[model samples]
Target: MSPPETDIAVRLSGVHLQFGKTRLRFDCAIGKGQIVAITGASGSGKSTLLNVIAGFETPDAGKVEILGDDVGGRDPAERPVSVIFQEHNLFAHLDVATNIGLGIDPALKLGVKEKAKIASALLRVGLDGFGKRLPPTLSGGERQRVALARALVRRKPILLLDEPFAALDPGLRAGMANLLLDLHRQEGHTILIVTHHPDDVRLLADSVLFLDGGHTLLHEPTAQFLDHSDISAVARFLGR
Candidate 1:
């Protein structure tokens, strides 16, 4: 029983990217509403693959499709995706609500409806009354909550998280992971998160995409990836 094309949230076929000495080639299809963890050695192009899908980096070749549409020609802003980075990427001076409002409208001309949406998003991320606080005043976890809130407001069908919880303490990271899982269940957004933590993958990802030497070494269900660390490369990477 083959799934329909519409069931694929993201597809990268024969995708290729190059930067100086580093060359990347990727091919994978992630199902709709699934959470996929992208893991690899530091320079294995994990983030770059996300960039290519988000339209931040143009691939040298191949198709980049989102929800059955070829979005390779679209700009980052035009893509049906929201990206959350490790830095949180919040404005130092902007209040939390305004930072999220920017996601709805870059000009920040947030209307009544937009304001309500922001409020709802804040609540969804467990930061309801903290909207007036500045980014610097919030703890690292709180700041990442703001980022997640912002992504929620965008209402994109796809979410790209580039090690967004990497800097958080283990407790905070686990909290964020649970929050993310809750949000995903509610929103049904297809998520691709780049992370180095096996626990993160174990906790959240339905599948794992393992990159090595600028190529996809493996892409399999989380159970297979975690249970069978017998594969030499994955074993070495997982330190099993």
Candidate 2:
């Protein structure tokens, strides 16, 4: 049940962002239903790139399109993009199901069909019966799952994840990575995940975007990148 491979889910053309005197630029196109993993140093602009694509931050130059529409001028809500961050941006006051349902719409007007879809999404993320639990009561990995469930319920064509498993232990991180791959296959959503972990890139990425010094140095198939000497250099730089 892979997502339909028909169109480009995300496209960036000469995209550039700047902070004071520093600049970050990206030029790429990602096809529908593929997982693109971005890896780089802490301040290499990985998260900023995700933010720009999600329409949370406007690039200083170039064009961004999602689902065939130019979205550079659109607000975050106007773009068909969902982001899952390492912080698990769940409402502490709300229960899991409610948090996921919020992804439906802030207007609070979901039809019966939408409610059912939310329920299914929650189940898909292994939070089936824990929807009544608040964020404070959940473990780190469980909370991450909840955040992912929220993203799933949105059913957006494109998803952006910013080091969502950084807080988990090794075993837990691997499990989450597998779960992400499964969800990607089942829901057919185009996914972009940012991580410094080579294992994660090896396990989940269809392609890799290697960023260094605020620039994309390489974009290649995961296996090919692994065998490349440049990837080894990145691994050593990250102490991986």
Candidate 3:
């Protein structure tokens, strides 16, 4: 049977954010299970937008919804959202198994069923036997897989990735992108990734969101956006 239609995963209506005197407003809707890439210059507020969705930053004025629930005033954990950042954010003192297991609950007590679930998550990310190793001992790619595994364990339908692969080499980056695509397909998670690389968008994004100076200037399918002359100009500006 075909998969069920995705309810809207994220929606922002008349969203406005202010940092002191400067303000940014934009409207956007991200479909469920779609991989949307947010791209722009350094100060374009791509990260800010993701933060707003993840409830890390509240918009000054607007409605924010995730999975059809009004999440405007919800805490980050209260929203059905997961975020992976550039820093990896793994606990240096914990073993990989403990780290991934913490995704389910940071309290660290798990029943047999929960332990099995954590093991399955590790296997899904190709880290089955590496669970006992420390995060400091793993390669960059391996560490990232652990991070992805954490997101998987959270079982949230909405995911926000903030330059999660920015520090990897070209080959590793490609691998991580492919891994993300695989996870998105398997889990049917709605994802919004903050990135500056056009090639990354081309490889993994179903839709593109271009932000310029804190405003969303373009939002369309990846192919359609790439074909637009104005978007191409912006892509050129980013050296894509």
| All candidates: TM-score | 0.97, 0.92, 0.94
Which clashing pairs does model 3 show? none
Sort by TM-score, best first: what order? Answer: 1, 3, 2
Location of the lowest summed lDDT over 10 successive residues in candidate 2: 1-10
- Write the residue-wise lDDT of candidate 3 on 64-178 in tens digits: 9777778878899898988999998999999988898888988989788878887898998888898889999999999999999999989998889999999999999999998
State the lDDT at 216 in candidate 3: 87
Q: In model 3, what lDDT does residue 115 have?
A: 81
lDDT of 2 by residue, 126-228 (tens): 8788878899999999999998988888878899999999999999999899999898888899899999898888789998888888888888788877776
Residue pairs clashing, model 2: 3-188
Q: How many residue pairs collide in each prediction?
A: 0, 1, 0
Judge candidate 3 at residue 159 and give its lDDT: 87
C-alpha positional error of residue 223 in candidate 3 after TM-score superposition, expressed in Å: 0.5
Question: How well does candidate 1 score on lDDT at residue 88?
Answer: 86
lDDT agreement with native, every candidate: 0.92, 0.86, 0.86
Better of 2 and 3 by TM-score: 3
Off-target runs (Cα >4 Å) in candidate 1 are: 1-3
Q: What ranges in model 3 sit over 4 Å off?
A: 1-6, 231-233, 237-240
Q: Could you tell me how far off, in angstroms, the CA of residue 24 lies in candidate 1 after the best superposition?
A: 0.5
